[model samples]
Target chain A: MAKTVTQEFTKGLWEEIAPFRLVLGLCPVLGVTTTMENGIGMGLATTFVLVCSNILVSILRKFIPAKVRIACFIVIIATFVTVVELLMQAFAYPLFLKLGVFIPLIVVNCLVLGRAEAFAFKNKLIPSVADGLGMGVGFTLSLGALGAVREILGTGMFLGMSVFGASYEPFAFMVQAPGAFVCLGLMLCGMNIIGSK
Target chain B: MTELIKMVVVLVLLSSSSGGLLHWLKTQTSSKIEDQQVKFVKGPALKSIFEGSSNDPTADRFTLKVGETEKNFFVGKFDGKTNCVAFEGFGKGGYGGDIGLMIGVDIDNGSVLGAAVTTHSETPGLGAKAKEDPSFVSQLKGLSIESPILVTNDGGKINAMSGATITSRAVCNAANDAGKIYKEIKSQLTEKVKSF
Candidate 1:
């Protein structure tokens, strides 16, 4: 049974969310979510690359030899990542500075490669585009949510504004490395519970 | 044979086009990126060094060729006189790598105005103090540009940050280099400052 375009797109939002469900591309998912702003910036950059690579891969799927398909997909992804890096540096220097090395590292994001191989390589242009956009938006929302949780609990602040009053003591650990793991685990557990129901 | 040929052709075409596109984009954004770097990275140091200047030091700047390198010199107007110039110097032997120091000097008296670390990669809470803690750079104020700068360990007046002697030495080294550059271009700098 073949799925419709809407089904393909919606699946990424909850059923196959990259970080939580697919468990793909954990490096950036964990590394950049210390702050909501950084998380969103990184997610959007990745999204740009994902959408571009998917479109190109879908268009050239016929010509790409099976043996060298991965290599071609990487080249496409890398080109878009560089484009994002240059544009970000030119227009959003502060956010670019915060995101730093992760922008370049997006070229190696497993989610992008996985999508190229699994979906874009076999699908038509429109569905490939929808898949890319859905996955990208899903990744962005997950990072943003995770970052908000971490920022609120760790610093008693939301996007630099104090959420808890002056009396609230922040859980500094929530902003640290170990905190990322614990928080992710709990979120994953919660997601699973909701998913099962 | 066709399979190999197709793969090679596809790769070459993709790589070359990618290169061409990046090159063009880089050229287009190069100037904007430079402005951003100066605004964010070097802007703070220049602001502090030229705190009371009548004009914006970043906007009022000129570049001069010194030994095959074009170095930017920011002009600061004080009391309607533009006799102050600030420039950057790099110090080698830092813990992480070379450290960049922005030194401001008064052309008339040949005295130091202020100095700040523009870029550094030293350990946090230690060598990084050169950039973070103002007291270390404050000691460099008002010193004559003609003499070489050194830490107290080297029998000079400036004191090194505790447990960060290497970083402190690197900063002093940068100050000394800036002084050398200043003396070499003193006459040319005065001429340029008058035009500003």
Candidate 2:
């Protein structure tokens, strides 16, 4: 009845992708996708927290009592989030500044917690690691794609290079908060259409 | 009873280890984080205020104990003479919160050299103009540091930005605070500047 490790890992890439399939962790998805760089930076930070927390949770699952498992999971997650925050501040201060409060807010991202509770807590160590890595890569790709669309349409630039030339007036609306919602909705709709077929 | 004891024991071990690890990490990264803040946030503010100085003010700095906290003062060398210093001050009761101002004073003339906003959360287009637009702060360039700075509405010389009185007042307050610090440490500052 158990799935192979490869199956567990690959599922997160498409079948159970965090943002598109599970529709989770939308706060950062909407907030920091103003630029492609910011989106990628936020994605990598979340990925680090996810993988580390997953490993720790999986290792300790048998020892942690079910009655207080959520609380234990939180402590583990919070520790990793702070580690990500501090490391970013030290090495990538500019990105840290751009991400701002969202870094600390990673502690409450449901995707990290959901994985720990649903998959890591019940799975073997290698499978948990695979699942975490696959999910992380998928999330990074989704955010990068979203960020590219918003940046290009909103500013007529990609990674700060003028893409549409001087005459291409920026749409302006695509970078704003409302634009994030519409962009995400369209992306989700497109995903469903492809999935249905 | 045994199950309850196990839960408590597990929680205690996890919390303590987490706390200990975080404490160690904070200590390791605190200095690096400070360097980043100095480079990104305070560095530009100091550069603008110390414009035309022959030396890099950010690199030539000294710390002095003011009240209970230590404050870093950057020295600007103009014409091969170190006669100016820049430091930061906090203005209370801004529209959003306290505004941070970096004030540069010419010790030789006992007058303000320039001022720049280091950090603030004031409203954009109005209060934010304090940092974005240079005109508001340029007015303080030649004013004597000994006199109290105020907006025109407060029966003083400087004019407040229309629709941003709160933010304007905050900037003025921060200048006044820096002036007060300058006065209190005038001797020590002059002494330190001489070494540069």
Candidate 3:
């Protein structure tokens, strides 16, 4: 039992990591990972929503009827997303501006709703929360790595600070939409090779 | 019948409580949210334009209702006199969406103290240059708000930003729109400074 509980949490970190492994929540994973700060901001925001929704969904799992459960879960998830939105606007306004549309779009992130239906509904609160945290951290790290790669190559800057010296010309293509796919694909390939052994 | 009633009870209880909680949270945070909005996003533009003000315009602000929406006005105490105020209004930019502009006007003279593009969705490296090239926006400074604001391409006083005539036009249109609002509400807005 103890081993299984830890596995549930650790599995989300690597074995079933989102975007790269499970291929979930690609909208944000592709859209906002243009900058390192934006990636971390978006990842943390989604994680907050995911963890909160997972915990609430688990707690209500027994009481909610199986038929109307999806609707109930949506309401729960949206409530938390709204809380995040308001809090972001209040305190973290600059990051909120950079991540304008993606924040509210968390309600439909599939990852949040998916966890509610897939894992949290079937599990107890502690494991549900742990799964959420692990998955969220995994997603955060993945996005951060992607954003750093894109920012460095595309803008020739890391976190807005110039890299490779002033003489080097940035391959601006890495910041555009097509660059996102190529970068993500390469990263996935690297992850696959590393994980195989 | 019992199952149907149970469904109704569960949904009603959950939704009503969620609504109540959200409403309370909004009330608790709306003030802070508005303050931060002005400070983080809007303050720099207002401060940059209203530089001579003795009072921080972001802090000395009032809201005026236009239709159902409330518009924020920032007061500037230029030379210790509070006759200047700033506000952001929208103009349709290169795209179909609204372009936000922060405009400062001398209520006494009706001349633009300064203007800046606070937010926009125009094409980067072109239309986005309107915000980057300070000279493009500086052209509007000291122009009488009574005259129409427009890019020279459309037979106006302002020069069009090189490759971004559309965005340039949008900024002019936004400034003109803000000017009209300032004209109509100038009396009410000036009254706000009386207590200051």
lDDT of 2 by residue, B1-196 (tens): 9999999999999999999999999999998998888888888988888888899887788899988899999999989998999999899979999999998999987899999999999999999999999999999999998789998989878899999999999999998998889889889989998999
Quality of candidate 3 docking, DockQ: 0.80
From the highest lDDT down, the ranking of the candidates is 2, 1, 3
Model 1 chain A — which ten-residue stretch has the worst lDDT?
A: A1-10
Where's the lowest-lDDT run of ten residues in candidate 2 chain A?
A1-10
Cα deviation at B11, candidate 2, in Å, is 1.0
Please give the lDDT score at residue B23 for candidate 2.
95
Recovered fraction of real interface contacts per model: 0.57, 0.68, 0.68
CAPRI-style docking class of model 2 based on DockQ: high
Segments of candidate 3 deviating more than 4 angstroms:
B66-68, B153-155
Name the candidate, 1 or 2, with the larger TM-score value: 2
Angstrom error at residue B6, model 1: 0.9
lDDT of 3 at B9: 82
lDDT tens digits by residue: candidate 1, B1-196? 9999999988888889988999999999998988887788789999999998899988888899888899989999999998999999999999999999999999999899999999889999899988888999989999998799999999999999999999999999999889889888889999999898
Candidate 3: the clashing residue pairs are none
lDDT of 3 by residue, B1-196 (tens): 8888888888888899889999999999999999998998798888789886788889888899765789998888867677887898788755536788898888788888998888887887888887777788889899987678877778888888777777888888889889888877777877886557
Give the lowest summed-lDDT range of ten residues in model 1 chain B. B33-42
Q: Clash pairs of candidate 1?
A: none
lDDT of candidate model 3 versus the reference = 0.88
Q: Note the residue pairs that clash in candidate 2.
A: none
Task: Kindly indicate the candidate among 1 and 3 with the higher TM-score.
Answer: 1
